[model samples]
Target: MIETMGDQLPAADIESFLPLRRCSILSYGVGHMLNDITSACWFTYLLLFLTDIGLTPRDASIVMLSGQVADGFMTVFAGELIDRFGRFKLWHAGGSVLVAISFSSVFGGCLLCQILGINSAALRTIGYSIFAAIFNVGWAATQVSHMAMVNCMTLNDTSRVALASCRNAFTMVANLTLYGIALAVFSINDAKTSVDIEDQYRWIAYVSILIGCCFVGIFLFGTKEPRLKQQHCENNQRVSWAYWFSKLLYYQVALVYMLTRLVTNVSQALLAFYVINDLEMAQSSKALIPALIYICSFAVSIILQEIKWNGWRLKAFYTTGAILWIFSGVGIFLLPSKIHNFMYLLSITTGVANALMTVTGISMESMLVGKDLNGCAFVYGSLSFLDKVSCGLALYLLESYQSSPSSEGCHDITSCQSVTRYGSGLIPAACALVGAVVTYTMNLHDTTPKSLSEPLLA
Candidate 1:
């Protein structure tokens, strides 16, 4: 009887919880570094790699969209399973293994064609699409598991925010690492032919895999599965998806999260194109400009760690980011190739804006889940579902028109009407304006978004 009573005691002992140590936060934060780095490569370079290797712009976009669609489909299912079974570590490990292997295949080129000794464009597209889809499946699993762990980590709101900031900082680190790798790969090897370009991307992919896997190992070794009290979670598994869908806040969050993702991802997808084909800058600018963005983003993420966060503060920071993107987007559209150096300034602001939106945007998931704990994975999955589909469709549509003539009758990047420039500038700016308006409409507070508890860590 006493043992049973003691077991029950833990369920009631809420206030006794202390903050998560910085080491724990840091360890957990680095777990997703693998996902972040791979995702950065996918968005920033996949189109360029595909186009450079002889795939049409339409075909390249199709490959990217296929991965996004696969990822979107996987997130909700992954979330459902994680919420039901509760082995976050297992899911994370399995997903990491998938990401490492399949991601390499996506960038490594058409193994199917190489084996069969055929050079069909359709065959290559299909081969790349298969690997891209597989990679995203693993990516979805890793992402959902890692993110859902935040709710189980602690009960303190401040610590939750700190954890998020730490995670964002690591994201910057991952981007910097990716660009650093690319710069070296591109610099040391001049690609005089299509085959050479493909080889450079393959090498970059291999190096990124090596670096990302080490961080995943650190995460698995340093962090233990949180002792989520069985009593609290026992009933949570049964929480219906409909319960989440019934709330108005769910829709608001879904829309805003989707918009945020579109803004970030779409901008990234178009950047390599803008810098190379449009701006006609040196090959090195491709890596250097993105490096500058992540450096500034990393600094801002560190400073965000020191803030005392709340609901309104989260919204404010997010809106500030959106507005910044608006200005950057417009600047990107208007800047002619003659002033290409000005892009460095825009990269700085873009990085800061990215950090602000990304950190707060992710935190809102925790807020929406509150103390519900039940099917929290589903909540994340559903949000990601929307994000993935929206981004995929947006990228597909924009890239489809890359070869179409501009209405203004301009022939080159200097005309400021190329699809690359238009997609890079106007798309994100439009999304940000809409996201800001939606953010203001949200009704949020410190307690579990709906009721009572620390707003952040638990």
Candidate 2:
């Protein structure tokens, strides 16, 4: 009896608790990175591209905001569908095809409108909005499916974190590389006196479509869902809709994450608008700024993983992130009006804060979710959806403020509107501070990194 009990002692090495189905994990990471690359290539440039194609600042705001509005309802409904379907590959394939076709069609339609002499400003706005809405629909659906795949890939927390780290690192690299390509395209166009509307404004869509198509095939070809090994999981695999509903009430981590995401998105969206319209920063410059931030964030994640924390793991991580945010806000407030080297410095500061917020936020969530990971992806999807809602609300509020006459900075960077714009960026930074405080107050039972008596390492 003693020998049997000893043999059955809980796993000491977290990594050993769940052996990685390595092939699946690798395929999953590569697929996710590619999808994000295609999606982000357009995502980072959507607002600027719309503005270039004759959409007014206000109209561009509406187009961006509309996607968020759509996401709110789509996340829950789509997540549920993914949970029930058990066919993530099909959705991945279908969504990729839709994305490719939708994106390619946008350019084709634009060329036709130009040739037919129907390229009026209103028509252009409508065309952009329609294409954006279609692209986002596929994006939302595929994201729900993708999250499900990630959850299914591993039950071990450390493995999942390692996977998340890989995904995020690649995501940053993809964003930087794609943005570099965009910057090159934009730079080339600016140097020439003549502008081909199609080349400058819509060719990236075709490129994104092509990249997405390749990945769709890769993901569909590579993955086969693993059969559940645990009796409890196998027995409960077909969780009823009512089960999902009832469990929703107890998802405290999900609620906290959603609120934090909402706050952060609102702040970031407004900041992007402010930087473009008020700061008058070049598109190439803006792309570079985010690249730097994401790189720094990737570094922070590596550091965060190695550090041994006790009671204050969550507290320390979030508090440091909050401080970076506030300091970055200060950088924004102090930036010189003339765009120059100081502008770059301010960008770096803001970028670092942004990275800290993102990486730390992700780590916190991973820690919070811990072992009960069955619906973790759904929680993530729902939080992402709420983030879009917050973005929508922020955009609406800013647009309203900009439309008003008394608002300063409406016409120039030196006005009250400038202040309003900067203020909006600071909102998320402030919220980060608040989130850190609230997180500390919560009574979460977190395991130390190395507990002598603990069974599993994760």
Candidate 3:
């Protein structure tokens, strides 16, 4: 085991990063950061847009839920196609083009509705649903290809962690910066005229398309694949779906990675609802806090991995994130409705936990996946899909209580608020706690030095 470890580790720790055979690695990360920013911008703004476009509670829910369905199906195919074809750049470019097209289509549809005076809720619902599905599908495909390429960038554990952390940090910055920009522009315009809401949104869509184009171009021109021989055998050389699926599922570390992501994403969804409804923060404020939290968390995670908690990095991530999450949940529950300051404090703590988990999860995944398999995208996409599903479930549970016909009177508001609070805070904390427990219980760190054979999938 020790020898295997030695073999994998570069002679110098600095040399562990991908040797620059091509500029693709750097470009891949850059593309991801750009795409992430664009996506976050849309996520932040889209909900409000639906409300603006006359979508009722039911219509908005239908649109998001339907997108989740499409997300699940697309991920399976995206993973398979990337793995079999190995055309990462092509997939990426195509995905970007689709994103531009989808967003434009949505904007056009909304504009058409305004022009024809056909602002019926049903029409808006259909238009939004179609837009949501296509947007997510394109995003998912690009994500798959991008991840596959990232997996090939380097073979070092620490380097991979560093790279993922850097990308995540940039993404967080993008999230925060774009929201700030949106808030500044939207607020100024919002005070001028109510009718210009669609105009403001159309401008946002134009920015989204530009970002998508940047990602597509960055990746298409920047990345170059290095020469690596494919593994071949006498008769079983061709890759099989069963082989990939089994390898992904049965690999010990991959199992751990998958479980952690599910927990992390569930937590993310729950928190989103909590911020908007429970704390009663404005959407822009909620978005800003999360961005800060992510950035701070990302920085702390890198330090923990590299220094203070270096040896037990994963443990630190799990334990710190879990404890903070638990406390954050308690804070949310006990926090007064008007205690916006305390709520943000609690958010900061939750952000730290989330940041740690994000970095650790990426590191663990890079460690688990095969050099040739390109499973990072699959794992990422699958994990991404699961998080969305968990978010949907959390939303369902929260909305069920909020919109329930039975609850009435002043007490009902409290009950509904309680649902929103717990829906965001407790659910994620519980998920993280469970993940920490399961991961720790595995005794993954206790493997005998001699027990390290070549990794099953690696």
Candidate 4:
């Protein structure tokens, strides 16, 4: 290919073609900062906020499930539409607008109640649920479009991985920023009434939205839609969904991506409750511990950009992360409140595991998509459909049982600390283990006839 390029191109043409720049990398990296910030708020604080604001665990789970269900369906629709119509930036911008509004509504208290003068728990739950679903709809659009951009961004495998790593690094920044904001809010609030307490969350939501929107504007300005799409992106140029269904690699990537999401989302949702209720830690630990985790994740993500990636390295790093989570889970399950301080160490370990698994898992998806822009959005959207739904169901089941009268005779090995322990510990470990095993079996790069047996990976 290099020799062919040399033969075809004049010396002047070659030099004129410049490589991607540091500024370009920064622009691409922060493209999803809004999604990252809002998502961090969603997974880390949604349940805790709902329960604190007076909803039952079951009700809180319902709101969460509604959002997940809406998100799951929207991913397919959005992916199909983007593939057929091909306005990546239009979808991204429109979705960002929806997210900014609906996410604010989700945390700003029940719009219906505020208007109707009704404060009933059921009504508030329903109101929050509506906004949650709407927020997730927009979220699906943004996530699918941004992830699919990896293929169109560049052909170099290393460059592709760099984009993903930079994205992950921004995600860590977003999470940390959220925790810092939450810590400041929690630290300053001295509310005695339910109204004041609710206002604190409202303030947090508003501030987060403001910060996220500013970065989103930067992303919109700096990034350009792929020029190739304008010519090739026609509705008739379709790859049948069956094209993906027949590939074993499709299933492998889908499963690992789904399970990896489960590990991250479920554990994150439970982290606050685990620290506050299970360990009886300080109120600030809810924010502080997660901040610590993201700090470590941010550092690791920056480092991953420097490494040369490949199939074996991907699997090895992912497996190592999984093994670390296994150890973290065991530590969580066995450590007593007597040694709650040790939870900080476990948090650090979990952060490292998160960065490793998440970056590699997403890079694997990019590898699978490769140059196949025909249904690339469908690939990401379908996988995310699985991810959102599975995560929703898992959290709903766990939250529903967290405060059960019997809890089905479940023992905490010390004290019955509800389902927080299991959700934050056991479930993620098992999911990681399964994802790791599946990663081992994946044929990362295959060379064969493109018509009948084109391998997905590079």
Clashes of each: 7, 5, 2, 0
Candidate 1, position 79, lDDT: 94
lDDT of each: 0.85, 0.55, 0.57, 0.83
RMSD of 1: 4.1
Local error of candidate 2 at 168, Å? 1.4
* Candidate 3 residue pairs in backbone clash: 24-223, 270-424
lDDT of 3 by residue, 147-251 (tens): 656555554444455556656665665666666666666676662342476677666677656765675576577666522212211222444545546753334
lDDT of 4 by residue, 209-231 (tens): 88988888888899888654554
Q: Which segments of candidate 2 are over 4 A away from where they belong?
A: 1-16, 19-26, 38-43, 104-123, 191-198, 212-224, 228-232, 237-252, 259-277, 280-283, 302-312, 363-374, 403-420, 445-458
Candidate 4 backbone overlaps, count: 0
**Per-residue lDDT for 102 in model 1?**
94
Better of 1 and 2 by TM-score: 1
lDDT string for model 1 (239-296, tens) is 7988998988888888888998988899888898788766778999889988898999
Question: By TM-score, how accurate is candidate 3?
Answer: 0.78
Off by over 4 Å in 4: 1-19, 231-236, 404-412, 446-458
| Residue 135 error, candidate 4, Å | 0.7
lDDT of 1: 0.85
Order of candidates by lDDT, top first? 1, 4, 3, 2
State the weakest 10-residue window (summed lDDT) of model 3: 226-235
